[model samples]
Target chain A: QQQVKQSPQSLIVQKGGIPIINCAYENTAFDYFPWYQQFPGKGPALLIAIRPDVSEKKEGRFTISFNKSAKQFSLHIMDSQPGDSATYFCAANPNNTDKLIFGTGTRLQVFP
Target chain B: IAGITQAPTSQILAAGRRMTLRCTQDMRHNAMYWYRQDLGLGLRLIHYSNTAGTTGKGEVPDGYSVSRANTDDFPLTLASAVPSQTSVYFCASSDSSTGFDTQYFGPGTRLTVL
Candidate 1:
């Protein structure tokens, strides 16, 4: 079974727009949530991360809104630009283990 | 610094052939991992090593094997190739001493089996 689930396999947005990618998980034991960005032919890189203790965290134009009770989390990109186009993946890791369970991923394309 | 390096940017192999995918890290991380990325399936862990000389199976370990003889190298081997094994493989490492440490990934090696 897929421990983490992501929606909208692909997304398209215009410059200056806001793009949102959402993910849900079934394991409440997961305490760490992180997002990764990957360009074509490259490995995924960490963008931002959040712990369940906080409801939201922001860094630059990226923001992670997490809802512990809902077992859901989302990534919001403000002032989206063409440079932001890439595949985004959400991952959850249990507190007891270092292993990470990743979501299917969302391919975002920001048009100029 | 070279966080991690994977050998053979891409490879094409025939079924039943044996192959080895190499991975090396320069950060002296305590943990290393092997993952395969497929379309729509995201990235799944194939194997992992908590420290030198200790390895464990991850979500998918069938037909794949790994060994960590030192802190810098963790190589994955395929005894026999199969078409279904075609995917982009990545190697990652982290400092396990730090709780919830971020994983750094390699450029990845794309393997195609026929």
Candidate 2:
């Protein structure tokens, strides 16, 4: 079973617009949530992360809104740009485990 | 710092043949992991090592094996390759001292089984 589920396999947005990607996980033991960004033919890189204790975290134009009770979290890109176009993946780490459960991924495209 | 490096950027293997994917890190991290990325499936952990001598299986460890002889290298071996084993594999490492830290990923190794 997929531990983490992500919606909208792909997304498209115009420059300066906001692109939102959402993810849901089934395991309540998960305490750490992180987002990764990957370009074509490259490995995924850490974009931002959040702990369940906080409701939200913002880094530059990237923001992560987490709802521990709802078991859902979302990533929002403010002032999206074409350079921001890439595949985004949401991941959850079960407490005390060294492994991370990743979402299917969302391919985001920003049009100039 | 060459966080991590994977060998054989891409490879093609015959069914039933044996193959090994190599991963190395220079960060001296205590934790290393191997993951396979497939279309629509995202990344799934195959195996991981918490320290130099100990290893553990992850979500998809069937038909695969791994060894961590030291802190820097973790190799994944496929006793016999199958069509289903063809996928992009990635290696990652993190500092275990930190409760939960970001994992640094290697470029990737794409393998094709025919």
> What is the DockQ for all candidates, taken in turn?
0.88, 0.86
Clashes of each: 0, 0
Model 2: CA > 4 A from native: none
lDDT of 1 by residue, A33-79 (tens): 99999999899999999999999999999999999989999999999
Error of 1 at B96 (Å): 1.3
Worst 10 residues of 1 chain B by lDDT: B94-103
lDDT of 2 by residue, A7-93 (tens): 889999999999999999995589899999999888899999999999999999999999988999999999999999999999999
lDDT of 2 by residue, B1-114 (tens): 898999989999999999999999999999999999998999999999999999999989999999999999999999999999999999999996778789999999999999
Report per-prediction Cα RMSD to one decimal. 0.6, 0.8
Writing each residue's lDDT as its tens digit, candidate 1 over B1-114 gives 988999989999999999999999999999999999999999999999999999999999999999999999999999999999999999999997778699999999999999
| Ten-residue region with minimum lDDT total, candidate 2 chain B | B95-104
Q: What is the C-alpha lDDT of each candidate?
A: 0.96, 0.94
DockQ of 2: 0.86
